[model samples]
Target: MPATRALVLAAAVICLAAAGWLVLREATDPGLAAHPVPGMGEMNAAELSRDGYLVIPAMLREVYVAFGATEEAVIHDTLAAVAAGPALETLYLDRAGAMAGGGLDGADQEIHEMELLDLASSRDGAMLSVNATWRVLGTVGHAEHMHVRGNVYSAALTLAPTAAGWRITGFELLDVDRSDAGTMVAAPEPAEATGG
Candidate 1:
């Protein structure tokens, strides 16, 4: 009876050891990549931060259009889709609502260029900071016709990965430079110069 009990206890120990090994393997498996953006799962902290920066412009474009259109439901949906945490989503939705409420018949925004300026990451990979330059065309209210408002924005972003995917945890506009859109004039034909 003593021998049988010893054997049973040993078997139980072995089973627990095997289960632990499996869990460890799954946690550290380098090949297990799951990310919505292709090639993102393979990126290290800096690279992930850069990629996260690149994705922001696209997300902003969608939300801007939705808000400009005064589609509250769309704004809520877009914010929820891009931002993961509940607090973050609510904050963005409120901002979007404000933009929509701005005195304008309609507005259109386009991100002309984006460059990742810098990135910092936490040791545990739980947080990231991304600094970037975003050149944008801000088309505000129309007069006779739509006009362009050139804007260069310096943005600082905090990002994290959640169950849904990568999302913006924080946002700050560091600086902005604005300029009036230049007017273009048509060239005169040679026929008028000759008095034809």
Candidate 2:
């Protein structure tokens, strides 16, 4: 009778050991690459530090909108500028990965490159001495009448974090130097010199 009891106890121990191994494997799997972004249910500023850079693509869109590149990039008889808007929107939405599913035109659409270097609280962050550079150029549909190319542009701005998320509290965009932020001008042909 004692031998029977011992055999049952040993089987139970083996089962528990196997379950533990499976849990450890899932937690330590590096190649699988899980839990990149934390969602609302996942955590807040406490467990994960709200001061972290919750890099949402929408914030980047807000900056783009503030710059108003849509009108500048497009020219008469050209489609490049018009297409860039939707394409830019697509790029930002993908940053959230598959878990985010898709992005809508709301608070989620206003986030961009949010590299939170400091976290004052789980609900707030500050970036007074922040440097940021973003460049995006994409073709619009299929058009041969124009080209979409420009020099790199950089700027510095101070961003702040709030309950809604990170925001540009204050910023100064110095000389663009040489940027093709659209605003292309057409060239004129010279008049006949014989009459002169």
Candidate 3:
């Protein structure tokens, strides 16, 4: 009888410890912005924030995947690959739109490497703000390319949540021009240009 009681107590303690570990991990690790269950999108910002601040990461991840995946080399023969990963998407992003400019094309990392440092994100009502430092390093048309770095770029975007949690619908990139600036050499200047 005593053995049975001890076994039950050990099991309960182990279960409790595991649960506590999961909660702590989720609170600290900014990477897993996953909403395993469908969020009740009917709630307002305050309500959503109450349930672990899920909106910001979800919206940001979508943007990262969308933007990072598309890359075409410029006049230079150099290649740039952008991927949507923890380095840029899940963790390491800031309220100022700060994130690493990763050249990750799905699983394929681009030859032309670009990284965004000190990335941040902010939300004003339905509008989400992204700011980050831009750095470009790799080969241009030549073999060595040009080792260059620039300041942070700011972007103000409007985000919306569908049944699939939060995703960016309409966004206004105030200073940065996505068409031409999204490149290796002739890309947008840095945070200063965008007033980030």
Estimate, for each residue in 1-196, the C-alpha lDDT of model 2 and write its tens digit.
Answer: 9999999999999999999987776556422222222122322223333323343223444444433222323221122211124333443333324214432222221222233222232223222334445455532111112233443444444433334333344444444434553433332223431443
Better of 2 and 3 by TM-score: 2
| Cα lDDT of model 1 by residue, 133-189, tens digit | 766665443333444566677766666666666566676778877764534333335
Q: Backbone collision count in every prediction? A: 0, 12, 32
Error of 1 at 170 (Å): 0.6
Question: Top lDDT: which candidate number?
Answer: 1
TM-score of 3: 0.30
Off by over 4 Å in 3: 1-43, 47-58, 70-151, 177-196
Instruction: Tell me model 1's lDDT, rounded to 2 decimals.
Output: 0.56
Top TM-score prediction, candidate number? 1
Compared with the true structure, all predictions reach lDDT values of 0.56, 0.36, 0.39
Model 3 lDDT per residue over 1-196, tens place: 9999999999999999999998887566533333322333354433444442344434433343333333332201111111122222322232112213443333221224344444456555533344433433332222223223232334443333334444443444335423333344543345743889
- Candidates 1 and 2, the one with greater lDDT: 1
1 against 3, candidate with superior TM-score: 1
